[model samples]
Target: MTHLDHITVGDQQVPVVTTTSLVIGTGSAGYNAAVRLAGFGAPDVVMAADKIRAGASRNAGSDKQTYYKLTLSGSEPDSVRSMAETLFSGGSMDGDNALAEAALSARCFYHLIEAGVPFPANHSGEFVGYKTDHDPRQRATSVGPFTSKSMVESLESKVRRLGIPVIGNCRLVDVLVDDGNVRGALFLRTDVGAARSAATEEEIVETNVGEEPSPEPTGTLVEQLAKEPSRFLLVRATNVVMATGGPAGMYSDSVFPHGQWGGAGAALRNGARGHNLTEWQFGLASIKPRWNVSGTYMQVVPRFVSTDAEGGDEREFLSDVIDDPNLLASLVFLKGYQWPFDIRKARDGSSLVDLLVYRETVMRGRRVFLDFRSNPAGALDADQLDEQARVYLERAGVADLAGTTPIQRLRHMNEPSYQFYLGRNPGVDLEQDMLEIAVCAQHNNGGIAVDGWWHSSVVDGLFPVGEAAGAHGVYRPGGAALNSGQVGSTRAAQYIAAHRAEAPEGDGFDAVATDVFGRAATLLADAVARFEAGAEDNTGTLITDVTELMSRNAGLVRSRASVLEALEQVTQWLESYPETVVVDDSSRRSVNRLFLIHDILTSQYVYLHAMKDYLDHGGNSRGSVLYTDPDGDLPWPDQDLGLPEEFRFVLDAGALDGVTQEVDWNGAGEPVFTWRDVRPIPSDDDFFENVWRNFRTDRGVPARQS
Candidate 1:
């Protein structure tokens, strides 16, 4: 069944190229993995969609992107152990893997800085740090709004310098899984950005002519697209790295770029199990010109405004909902730390802003917004703020502007925050117009399950890193995503380099390529027939329906009834996929969309089913994993499943003391879950020893350490 010639995919003939290590995705994690493998002298081919800069890592903007690292200075008494404890305290699964990530965090962060990422260091050459979502220690630093961009640009430069190959405009379509092992992967090279919807995209800000654009990453597929249209290309490798970033576009209300469908569904279909798929982090974000409004968006005390559809009836909505003025101001300030929505926080009024915003947008069916030009009308008197909120402003050096306009405080606190809106959003003048907002899907704390070696649990030689590697529990620190990319990439690379000698050469390129080619061709041929037949495709509407399903049923707050209902609808959609057509262009964009939509359908099934099971088994209401009703704050029907009655499951820094969830598999081999233990931190054991042992086999020290 092996063939050396090119495979026919629609009108395009795609050639098969084989390599040793194939890295899927060219974002922060993928590029870092590619570069590290290259540094270890391992050949790697990185695959990307549209371009390397197309991921949230490169495109997503935050006020000052928090890059969480362990405190390098001895000023804070933090260690790998403390960081590990914090990671595990976020809740869900094992902490052993998280412990390893914590250990390598400092090294990887410093590595980025050395590689030319200009992390903002003060005049004294000291990289000062600030607080982020989940950290007591001041371990976060930033270089304005472009933290991931900086990391990626530096890594991209290093990648170019080392001549690592990165293939762009490719979407991972068919994974070469044979004999229970992943040997290679296949991608359809085409522009399927319109797969989800034809909603008009906003204009990206233009850089000055003299400013150099980000460097292009170079990679070889065996990617075989010659621009004739859609071509099926196969890349055979000794190992495949999954770094496709978060599952965006999965929700109707998401901050993720509209076209950001990724590898979660691809991995799941191929029997690659994921971790914490039911657990996610959702919060407020901008819509039209998609962006996450975090950090200073709330810190500067923007006025929470709402209005009718015609822009006539203006109302300061938060004032009507909340009675206590100081509590209102304090809740806004809490958003600086508790950015992601948690049902537990909502009950205590901490996450009320998110709930109120949700209520306004979805329930009341009114537009909600954050206007920086003014404070909440008649509510935000400087003397009216809680002493804590007032003092926080003073500490941030914006006390003088506390009594002034919100934009005035924003300018004093974060000048970049004021300037970020100069031209990006249409009609959005922070100095004038109110910024429309919603509780959008921010990040999935869930993704492909992997071992300590960063290898996929389901397949040998498959390494899942970055957001693809769901090591995070229910919640994580703000900038930990960037840190996780570096740490996981480094681990995956080190493991590959150190163990490549002993890895079983799973399958030859010819056999794997031939098999994958047939699979891709058949799928493509059938999909093309659908497009040609005009098979009842409601792709755009279907995508919108599914996203709306996630937003309404399975967003930050969820209940068993809503989730189960959503599952019913999703299952119906999956069953009648004939109703969904692959939107196409001459480039076989339709064919490509077929694969993407299928992946999404399966991913939805996995999330709903897993969540249902967890709720059935008495999964506690906590963090971003909401189960019980938020309205009555009703307790989940504990089906006699023993869990700590008092476990708050707070997803914050130095959060809840202890918890764990043991993982299992269904008879079909899909991942299953159950509660494990409430581990108390032992004071007697040496902190360093616990984490040190995590790096070793307990049999011996790793060669890198030696």
Candidate 2:
């Protein structure tokens, strides 16, 4: 392990105590990294984060477990390799390494179950799987819809059992590096509000060094003004692993709730610092040709049928008009026509599946109404249906379900579902609902470019896992994110362990710490200046700008114009960021203002990167967004974005202009921003036959036997 230099606490320098393998972020990736390191007998493994499970791992709607069934129509037989290729198929950057990582991730689910995760199981004790939109297989496994919750609980239990030290509510402001290798990190202990004031004063002292030290430390003033006490912590370690999630909170509106956005904010701020350090000492390599995340995959479960005054099921009527082969397939699977069916309708023929999907979309302020109100059964046994509905409503925290009719209940359930489930309802809705729904920003399929071994070309001793790494390609299959986290974490841990002996003793550890602290102090000073200038007081304006841009331009639909407009708005926000201010309250140590500032900055980074990628790969709506352009002006071919190339980086570097550049697609290096040769689907008779076969097989319901 690397030896620590002096620890800084409110201008007081303390000697290093010990060193450990430090895992940053406590979500799935971080947890897995710590667990695997401990399993390998790495001494003094410490996992730290601002908020552990509060990130994407906990905020995700479902656990989504399998991808074997998500093969593109008429593609080769599904295998781990084939799946990887498909995931990286698009011109969007990501490469083969993502495929290997995802393949390994699939096995992680089994590992979770072995660790006593208690995933939903059938009577036979086999894991019960269900179908979701985008995937052809009913391979998704969950324990209730709160798969993230269950997964977090199980991992948390495992971490505790290992007796690994976990420091929560602490932010890692900087990573200290020496001689092109990672040595340790600088952290701000955030448990005590009063301590934060002291730390702020210490920061001022550290910056003003070489000059006479202030006789009366400004930290004292911070204490006098603070409403609560704050504490700061610093940890020094040999190895550091970044398992931070994506940037969502910085954006005004996201598919995830408010809290989930903070992870993105932290990652953006801290990641920028880490990347910068790596760039200065060691040349950085990044996967280029980033994949375009056009929009979220949306499906709405049409459970409740809207009715007239007399009450009628409009859904059944509309069902006749719309050829809902997907819905029928679900019914067939649930009725024992397939191997993994668990969904069952109430006695009145109502299913929670539709309601769950409907409520989620409604809460997002999107339009979702059922058409089955005119059907004859819409009015059938209102009282009995209401009773069954009551069971679900109560569980969802809908106390007023008793007074509302089924149709009315559907409308009322929207708010509560959003408040509770993060915009998802389980069992009561069909997975098909996700197919046609509008969405807020959900996942970033595009991430840092990496190789098959999970190595970033930009820097050594730096690894990104889970959502932070971006290995899933353009569109990830359900449950694949969990798989990616496990795979990346495991690979990273193995690499670190194997290379531990060869790692050089870092030089200038103290100097690196000083630099890191210096940067953080600068950021804080700028933030303070903004607050004092009253330029940062436009919190409401910033919020409104972000919400409008994201909702209108980056939502479930997209076009070049809208995307460009959104980018323009993001640019303006970024320009205005340095001037933003904090109100300077009693809780200077907690630094909610700093948190928000970081969040906004990171959100802008993601938005700008995504927009640039979208423009580079032009085509009609390919994934979730519909492209109205008849000519398909996009430069990249219309092939399904595969995993390998989309996730791996061959070269990465930051431009002098501050824009980060990456090279991907098997060392094709930096993309020329030109169109590629297009490939056409074969017209052979077997093509259609195979398509029919796979479609029928995906439903797991027999179409016809040979």
Candidate 3:
């Protein structure tokens, strides 16, 4: 490979290089794969993102980041079959990937602990587990609110010890592909420019230092930002693993770190097959400093209240709308297990909490807040909380909090829940004030499609782990994303190692580089042309439009008319890309933002289109992506999927597998979605297995093959 751009590394110019395998995104998944590859002695490299904890895994935290695993050290006699059964349950969209994930979850969990992740465990040497989301077993555990962050910390330490080459502050902007095999990736070193930008920011006093600084430019008032200086390194790799997470920050109402768009477009542009792009997960969280307030936060059952701008009538809003106050309090307790908004629970009081919160914040004119200093109207009595809530409180040893203030109860219970916030440099005292909440796009259960081993089925030599891979369907078990990332990345690493020597690097290097270069050049030329033509900067406007559209049309609730209108607007923005103004001349931040716009638009194009198709093909509500036709009523008053008894609109999880969408780029690089039947991962209970084996034997295969 030739040197595209040069950068001084401690006064030495490091040229572009080649590696056997390249792992993009330095989050948990990417780092895990890189370390595993290094363990196998198959040379690999990692981009130590702008900051060690820049991506979603490191930055985002919640009441408790659940880490779901098997019985392991727990008292319950849980088996892999039982684990897989729970994994496929809960109306989570189908695929046999969950079965494989379940089979591998135990090993992955232990792997993290071995790598120095400090998960909570009992003195008897058993890792403690708790219930989360849609799990029937006590398979979830966490270390405060930083489970993902702790995993990242452990993985980073291991990577450093192994001496796997890390190009810190680099971004994998594009991948070089020839004959459908990934040749390498083009990475831009943004650290140098970032440091320069930071030095400029140091002159300002009112800046959030050490944080992902706001997208503030430091240039002359009249001059548009010049193309910020950068060092582009094109690494030629035989295998490329895109462990970057899903595109979560594309929407404004998101809990992900600012401007962190998962690099999905790099694969989409190469005509890679993307599955489940329509199935993103959303929930309630604090908006200012984004964080999920679930687990113990909800378990403590804080007072749900909202206030107007003037702050006159302090009201427990749920009591006003819901007829029964006891049911309202119980539903608040249920929010602990039912964190994500489930459509089937829409009418049921379980999911009504989310609807009322969203309604209070968005639909109604009020700012919703969860006050820990107080309790709900009738929460004084021990009988008010259901047996499940009391059981959890007893397990957490906070059962005595029946008559105490929510904060005092939380203090005796999960100290780290509040301590985690106070541990920040300029700490937050949750005891004093209420935490503002909003419905934000949290985890994405959708992304690039992969086979059982997590290798991209269409783009050979390309593996997508973590959120980058669409292994998750609809709703994930609370901490399953962490487990899935570990499992998927390890599988990707093992697959790459098994075939490392066989990868052909020299076969079509020139051809791959030519095409990648041409595409990049065309985009750059268009950008420059637009800048020269006095194009107005509509990137901000576009982001607002995209975020609001997704929030209103395709968010927690959806209607056909609203989605079609959103589609029309998104289409118009796509057509207006030529006239879009991107001020990159004087600022690299602007360039990054411009690139982010491109990435989001590309990913959203497929997402919005797939959603339209999903509703068109009689796809009803399941997880967060609820579809309501404007002309017709909801496919509701139905009961299935282990749903709460009070609600309607339960999507048939079994029927979901037969109705799936595949997004592929055409000759013009525009995505076209086609519906396909994906193989479903049936529950692997002992009885189901025997019957399935018998059925297979009845068909053709021998029973012993099972």
Candidate 4:
């Protein structure tokens, strides 16, 4: 049964929604959780979303977005243990989560397939696969550029069929906790319009200067409420599944969909432990349409160009770095497969292209673009191509077209990729104009800590799946994230179905809701008061500033000094956010913007703190980020590439690989950091009878072997 009650917030009455299970995203993981929960005898399940169809799962894609799974059609030897070992080998990954992900991968993949996500299969009815980055076996598959999108659509269809209610336009402001456990969540209903009609014009008065701030007058409360033109929604759920995606707003150079700032801030504020917060995945992406420019986009070998702020001063930047035309072209080709920047490959591999792009854009403050209209250094002759590049092109049937322009080869090789740009709004005619690019933040490898059953490490009945869960460690295979989201969500649903299917017992909710919403109201009131007193609205500016700060200091490149400085700045921003942040107007949009800024700042502070702590623990460059080593050699130091000293990084040669760093934001003071050994993969009884007996006894959800 769904109960709609009311709670008093200041003088306003906020609606309270009660449900058995609440899924806090409309992404693949969230929708799947809802579908699975409903299917597994859960009494009631509802979904809450910031915006329907407005997330990375729907908007983000690459040339051929991959989904990693166990090898299905190959003659090659493979097992659950082998797959788990491969995932765990990524370093810092917990062996048990890896094992769980590996064991359930096929079940989850087939679930997607059964739900109508059309993963390709051969005539023999075997799902074909390919090798992706960090994968030794051919365990990757794709339906197209929008694998996650397809998954979301299919799972959403299932959710709809199950009659699961999805409430959109709900921005999670806080996760309501009671006595250390999750009670529910507080949200600002963005769709509510002009609900504060009781306030009169006389009540909306400006205070005389910033005199000792008195208790808000009835009018002041109404006036603050009026600005929002919205209402608060208090949702009390037995279980809250947070699949709110990554902290996209944390980086200015991000490919995450616009307006999907993520709900991690809410979880973190509620004392959710963060695991591997320092592991982020960065890659090259087009800035305009915000899509990963991996695979065929790079294999075509488009000309790399740089320009001044006004788009003038056109120069071939890569040509300036590498004189060998074939080597330069080969590296670009390699970038197709080795898309994300790996530290091991930074010095003498495809990742050097990433560094050059960073140098031209971030370091030199020039705009970088892929000029598909022209060939790099007037390229010609497929015979002159490196063997790897030539053979790949020959197999792709683009070898003979290599002498032609990049666009021509792209069209002949992958027409869909060439047409993808033309299909975008304000589309780029790759045959004519240059496509601007950046070293974009694509995903976070770490987030809220969880156990084998995808339950939050600290909060009972709180599960963080998808990118929100810090399931991955230092590195992951391409498409592993998609699989991880599926498997993790499935596990959470199974556990909830068997154990926590009933509504939470409570009397603590009233107190918790009052405390949480009261705090939120004060923060909002402070913002409005600051705005009324002539404080300039820096909401947009602050977001840009924070993103820029993160991208610069805590992005793919890091140093002890830079991280410490950035962490200090974030700390200052957090301290002053309420008092200094000004809402442009009373519109719910503006109010939400203020809250978003705080959330972004809160996330940035936590992330930078994790980075600072990691560096403090003698962490060196690994995964997507490179920690600068003053003693290290620069890329092609023998050449005159004008590479900055900061680019000189020494890779951490597996010293800290066996351990993982976790951070806890206790909602005050400095975030505490802890390092722990990764949980080893479980070797449980494989005898069918023993497993079946435990499975049956435990209601189909076995206890965590670890």
Candidate 5:
């Protein structure tokens, strides 16, 4: 057990302090909460986190717009009402009301614009829009491809302008809750050495913002020490908003390194870390699990097609000859590559290909090449092509090859052909173009379930926003994530503001403070003992283990066996965690230790809970498949049981304890599933209407009829 020498209260090391609201994350949602609360005249809003903008908001591709089209896509006509209903149907929905309120406050975009966010605009000054894969309309509005960065900058600027004090690099150790209400949080500054040595260099770069060169001699060690241990800042509040990004740490395998990938889906797993709040709510907008589905359905764009010396179209011949889906699938798997170009067979038996710029090469040494040699040179927009070329070169550390055809040839020659064409004479190049092929992790429609007002059922005074909250049903429309964040945050702010004034002062604050400090003391003692014993038992290993387990068992493809395996792995990790301890030189006053511990525990709980629910729901193929074997076969445990078709209802019911109700597929058959419940549709509208209706009612907005 850990022990504490003292606790700090105000300037004195005593015990506790209280405030009006506590905003728990530094991302878009947290910032929104603080700013909104301040605007609404809430006193003393405190924003806490290990790092702000380090969550999904910072890592997002920032496709700005309401993904109304994707939400409405599918065979059955889906409306706002149906969308909301499905979001809430699984009891995982939270913040429906908040989302609705945010929809009403669409002018928040204008507010962001005023904050200097550079949204893409057209010649007429209206927002420019583009279409995405699942979207039914051109709703995505981007500022080049770095929209997430731009938005983060704008939000950070606005937060500073509002005079909101942010304690960066500080991690919350524990939430102080009393009588079921949040009082404050325990915190610790993460010791620089505690993070992996490799991360120290990155940390330095991140923290050296706007520092000028020093001409004088460097300061002494004593001088640096005097400035060390920056004040342990804590803010007590009556209300708290959890805007931590999604559970990326929880699903580390599926998510790309921070800021490397363009999709928001992979970042949703970060919310898993925040699920530890004892009194906080948990819910997520449901979204279609496409990352595990269409994401694996590989397509390629041929950059340069080869032709024979006779000048016959070699590219045409290859397209005409290679029309087998099995061959294509095999090629994609063996080459460890996905095509960049959209290849389609024409009615005349030739291929119509839309060549795109190449992004990254596959392991098979096949460079993504775009075949533009056959087209008139410069027929395509030169500026757009140049921009893409620059982006690829910068990311891959390649030199300028603009307007060079040989570069395309070099890339194409290095690529391997499918087994079927191994002995065939590869043709000569007919066209040379750059092709960008990226196999990115996209879409995490799964998350903490939320209602119209992003609050958790398990805990009050806790709200989740952005990708953390699961509101998008089975499939999220392309632009809805942005809408969810903006609207969810705004609505959460409204709820906090409205309730803060009426919240009765209680003993929960003191009790919460005591509990938090007690836990911190225990952690500190554990660290000290670990140090004394000269043992290295940190939470990172456990976290990594969980991540590996999730990747192996709960990723891309899933089956009964894999889900069960994941559940078993989670249980084993939990059992092994208690024997582990993190050692840090940083004082107990900091929040680093608290943050790490909370994150690890929360991650485990949320993932296990989610898997439990997912397993409980036994249907045909729904959401993303998590456990498909290498041979691409589903492995259900009871395949030969020959149970009634209705028995499969367990799959659609989500996490079933004794309390939660099962999905009523019989009543709302059309939207929830395609075919019969026995043969589930890959994607269907199971609970959209109910989820949307709740959202509409929560926001006091008129629900759109289906």
Candidate 6:
């Protein structure tokens, strides 16, 4: 890392760091990208993050967090082309990216193994695997519940060993641009005095950092800011890799670990186009220390219970809807394998469980829980379970037809599942208390657009890998995201090392940097100036309002009116944010919150706009999202499900599968939305000599077509 001449912004001296490559996250993808970039001979690489210990990669996992890869052990007939075809089969996915992910899956997976990610392997030295949702082949592997955490730690060690600089406590404020190219990036440093704390008051000169800087205020806010210093840090790089996770902060009911507010807002604010932003995956997950409650947690046939606002009136909500106890148990068991809520399965399949959860939690304002202390409907006879459920339970050696409770079955079947909750900080003993759960946002199927090499489609010198990049589409195989992150980061690092190795020419960057910093300073100053000592701190309320709005209208269930209303409200929020949103304190925490709210609102507007546009385009219920169609038929009309008219919906059934919705925010009124036909899978020539010649020339990184 090289430090360039310092620039003055609003009476503060800001340090500018320049590098060949700058990675803006510290997740598995970001760490992998940095390690690979340095390994591939990139001159210099650096990583910047808001918090080093935060992010989903290190803090989030499931019953058995999986890593999807090509079939390596089984005799199943699997090939690169076959895996690519399966990935492309997911609606609205780009074919080239699918092919790239498939072709490089093994390389990335092995890279993880070499980095010390202990993926299970059989005695024959073949990596064993199991099938996951939407997977045709047995191509999923895991190292227990902490699979991603293991991957992050392993890759992070590689990054540290490579001597990469990881600047922490810096939140990305914006992606600075020059004309149409990515010049660099701007970050808000919460720890400002870490570099030069000994500067005397006599040496420092006062200058107008904001639009007009005046005498320092004597208010408590000024003293508070003095104690908690904040400054802006500029990173000038030739290549910027956005490996930040998905836009998980946009929804209140989300499984994304806290502090995983992604960089999509920064990319989108700077002209990066979003692809298929409307597609997201939602599933049942625990509340505190948020974690996915998939696999055996559901397979145990835990009793689904709900209570009123005060947790008084306890009732088995699922039993209220479904009279057949066996069918209910069967549905809950199926949720273990078919975890994500699927519109196709909403009729009579497992996803009906998700709907009931949603109805109880969101519609009726009740608290839902998975009660493991007892069985539902008195006693559950495993022999009476549906054939699929009975066989799975018996195969797992937990087919207790007697009086065993869910907790006992869980302990006998998967001890790791029981221990996970038992070992948490505010732990829950399944034998004693119920596990609070809700239908929560798990992942975004689409995000910032990227091409085959994981390079940004909208900006030069910009690459978006991992969840930040929209590699998946309407539906993806479970655990495919982990593979996509590794593969995409590797592709990005390779491309950068080969083509964009040199630092960006620092000719006109200072001017651009100054302008960008000036805008941020003005916003911060204005917010500070508007701070009131005893003013009602609506900051928390505002965040809750927006997040709840998303969860209610734009979550699994949606309607045209609710979406439009939410969109309009968000627009109003965005318009009045500067004037309306006030800070309780001017500390680093408050300042970070100030900027993050802006990012969240910007993301919400763009996402909600994409959803509204899709509805306007006549897009129906598809993927995890269920659009209300009053004219449509009820999913289970034959049964007295008591589902409201709002639940009446029709599935798209591949009608809109061939197209992708793209949105771009110009930092103006509303983001521009458009639809484009999905690119077909390529049929490349496999002639050995021809491919070898091309590989020899370009190192197999194909040139982008003009």
Q: Judged by lDDT against the true structure, how good is candidate 6?
A: 0.84
For model 5, the stretches where C-alpha displacement exceeds 4 angstroms are 1-17, 62-102, 191-234, 256-443, 502-506, 537-540, 582-598, 627-706
Output the worst ten-in-a-row residue range by lDDT, candidate 3.
216-225
- Residue-level lDDT of model 3, residues 276-303, one tens digit each, is 7777777878765667777667878788
Local accuracy by lDDT, each model: 0.69, 0.44, 0.68, 0.84, 0.40, 0.84
Clashes of each: 8, 88, 6, 1, 116, 1
| Residue-by-residue lDDT tens digits, candidate 1, 1-706 | 1122455544556665556677888678888998888787665444445445567777676788888888875476888888878776676645656777688888898899898898877777777888777787888888888788778778877877776666666777767776567777887765432344332442143221244566554333222334334355666667888888877757878877655666777777666766777777888788755677877778777788888777757888776766666667778877866778876676554576887787677666788888887666545555567676678887987765446877888888888766766645343568877888898887887788776667886677788899888777776778888888898888888877776523335346557666556666665666556767765544556666787888888886676778889999878877666444554534344555666776777778777887887666656566665554433332222322122222223222323224444344321344466554443333434577876776575322244221
Better candidate number, 2 or 3, judged by TM-score:
3
For candidate 5, the C-alpha RMSD (Å) to the true structure equals 13.6
lDDT of 2 by residue, 1-706 (tens): 4333355644755334235577778777788888877776556666767655456565444212232222222323455555555444432434444456436645676777777777655576555455543355454555543466556667867887776666655565555555445656655554544324444321221111133321221232123322323233445566667776665544333444333433433333333221110010000000010011111101112232333323432233223322343443232123211111011121111222222222233222333233211222322222233343334435644334223333333334343322232222221222122112222445565455444445444445556676667455334455666767777887777666655424334366666666666656556667666666654444445555666566555543345666677777666666555555443433544354454544554455454545456445432233333222434322113333121121111111111111223322211112222222222212223477776886575432121121
Question: Lowest summed lDDT over 10 consecutive residues: which window, candidate 6?
Answer: 202-211
Off by over 4 Å in 1: 1-13, 44-46, 191-230, 310-312, 400-403, 423-427, 501-520, 534-537, 578-582, 585-589, 630-706
lDDT of 4 by residue, 1-706 (tens): 7566677767877777788888999899999999888877888787888777578897688889999999999598888999999999999999989999999999999999999999999999999999999999999999988798889989987877676777777888998877668899998876664333243221222111232332222332223333444357788898999989988889888878675689788888889999999999999999877789999989988899899999999999887878788888888999998999988888788899998888788888999999888788855567887788899998987886445788988888788887777776447788888999999899999999999989998888899999999999798999999999999999999998887888866688888999988888888778878888888777768877988998988888888889888988989989987778887555656676777777888898888888888878988888998899898877666776767899888778888889999888878988899999999999888899988888778866865442
Which residue segments of model 4 deviate by more than 4 Å? 193-230, 637-641, 703-706
Instruction: Give candidate 6 regions above 4 Å deviation.
Output: 193-230, 532-534
How many residue pairs in model 2 have overlapping backbones?
88
Task: Please tell me which model should have the higher TM-score, number 3 or number 4.
Answer: 4
Ranking by lDDT: 6, 4, 1, 3, 2, 5
* Better-scoring candidate (TM-score), 2 or 4: 4
lDDT of 4 at 491: 94
